[model samples]
Target: MTPLAIPAHERHGIRVFAAALSPEEMQRDKAGLVAALFGDPDLDPAHVELFDTADLAGVGLAGYLAEGLGVSDAALAPDRARLEAVRGPVLILHSRALHGRAVTLIPDPRLTLLAGYTEERPPVHFEPLPSDAAKGSLTAPGPSAPAPRLPRRALALGAALLLAGLAALVLAWR
Candidate 1:
């Protein structure tokens, strides 16, 4: 397995390996955002354990994270409740491969299910309806400046004056 190496500065001192595993195979049974986070050596291992989407939804991100982060059960009740209230998909690893040795694996999906963790965005992809705005929509908070324009009255007046001047010159030349 080709290990994705993070820079030393990026990860303090621990050796963190993020295995960008495909659906066919995973190096350490880690996938998605969990694998991405686990790739950092500084993160607590017990907290970074496998969490498929169902497991996350069932436990609530607060409860799931509380346990993973080694916090008390009651500590994350609010977080869990918030996740339960939302209908949208939560960030989680889709599936985790069986663990082997120390390296952790994460899946490379058909499209990115998570963002905002990094400065860069995932590559663009095409999606059908309930259309994904990020992929195709041109709508944006209007541009920093308005579109340039020439007033219709001004343009018409300028053209008329130029034509009048040309006509005068032609008459004088004659």
Candidate 2:
């Protein structure tokens, strides 16, 4: 029995079967399917798959899509294999930005197209610190200066005063 056109809501679960269909055949099929569902002629051929919904869903269509679309499996093979081995839902995304138009097998649809583009701005200027702040207060203190030494002359004067005071006291006692 011929399969009915897949519903839009069910498109997520529907498995696309794509192969070496001639360019002409691909155009024709693409046109018909696009008219029925998206009503747009810009359907991405890379998004198409070749397995039935059940098999694709069962085998994790994301990995199959990535491999079939000539996407690099080297980076994603291990994780893809693990997901396929577990038989879980898969979502694959193809973009020129990532792996160069290669199909990337993303096991979680949430993970696909997570990164978005935005115009970047130039770096902002930072204000310099104000001057006049105490260097020791503003910055950590370094080694302190050594303690002051007493002058030799001052020491000699102190000794003379002590001797004179003792001599005066002895004379007063006499």
Candidate 3:
């Protein structure tokens, strides 16, 4: 098993690894997943190193994929014991359809599972707080300022415009 390494310089920030039971979930919503994890656009990318479990197997982490789960092409399985060798916390983004099964498949105490996907902007502040023991005095990256929200007046104006457009359509239909 090729150990997942975080260079000495990168150790100060949280180490993030992404595993998926379904490859399509990661393939389709990777950016959204990252955004969901680190909502602050200004958060340094180096603070979190995102790696796909599928790609890990290519790099010689054998048996990285789950086996005997009766599912085809399942993502890295903590059941294999190789995951224990990982240095930090792992975040598993799995299909909503397998929410129940994911619980049973991944039993590593270090792994966190997030089920479901949405194309719309995801809720922010999704990262789990790392324990001091796990991080070893390393300073976790601070979250940047939240995205500025539209003022009430701007929102009201947009709503009014939408309502007017709808009313016009209704009148034209008559």
Candidate 4:
């Protein structure tokens, strides 16, 4: 299994959102992994969003790849299982490249696990994606996805009105 090579054109929008799964877990979790890459494999690539990795954050098979690796650095080692795990969920956004062709990665010593295929990259900031099904209250909201502010004054007024109504009822009963 070769290291999964994201093509030159496709790498820009490829961001692993740092919410439900940590940056560490995103490299490994199955649901988070699959959702981030292939995007609900049932759908075609054009309409599919590339990095919505939050969907499978808490699945039963989520951490199968990360299992037994032990420590973050050790998980970074490039191997057959690592390559297989990486390739399994990744989608080919461009075409239906047929089987039996050997895929080659342009070997660069500088490339690390987080290092993407491209050189000049757009800012991949921590923007909170809307994932009520995924993070819920477990993680902090991303910059783009702020949590809804509570309507404090409305609640207070409602409570006050209820109390007044109760008092009037008590007086009428007396």
lDDT of each: 0.41, 0.39, 0.39, 0.36
Off by over 4 Å in 4: 1-49, 60-98, 107-174
> In candidate 3, which residue ranges exceed 4 Å CA deviation?
1-11, 17-21, 38-41, 45-47, 58-174
Candidate 1 per-residue lDDT over residues 1-174, each given as its tens digit: 333333322311212122333434433443344535435433333433332344455565455444543334454344445444434233332111222223333323422322111112245897676745546657568658877899999999999999999999999999
Preferred candidate (TM-score higher): 2 or 4: 2
Q: Better model by TM-score, 1 or 4? A: 1
For all the candidates, what are their Cα RMSDs to the real structure? Answer: 18.7, 22.0, 23.3, 21.9
Q: Please state the error at residue 54 of candidate 3 in Å.
A: 3.4
Candidate 2 lDDT over 41-145, as tens digits, reads 344645532222246654454454454443345544545544444332222222221223222232211222211111222468977557756333555789999
* lDDT tens per residue, model 4, 29-130: 444444443333332334222233233355211132234211132433444233333322222122122122233333222222331211233357997777
lDDT of 4 at 115: 19
Encode model 3's per-residue lDDT on 104-165: one tens digit a residue.
Answer: 22222333533211122224786656765555466779999999999999999999999999
User: What's the TM-score of each model vs. the native?
Assistant: 0.23, 0.23, 0.24, 0.18
RMSD of 2: 22.0
Model 1 residue runs over 4 Å out of place are 1-47, 56-58, 67-69, 72-78, 85-174
Clashes of each: 4, 6, 0, 2
Indicate the worst ten consecutive residues by lDDT in candidate 4.
91-100
| Residue pairs whose backbone atoms clash in candidate 3 | none
- List the candidate 2 regions with Cα displacement exceeding 4 Å: 1-30, 42-47, 56-59, 74-174
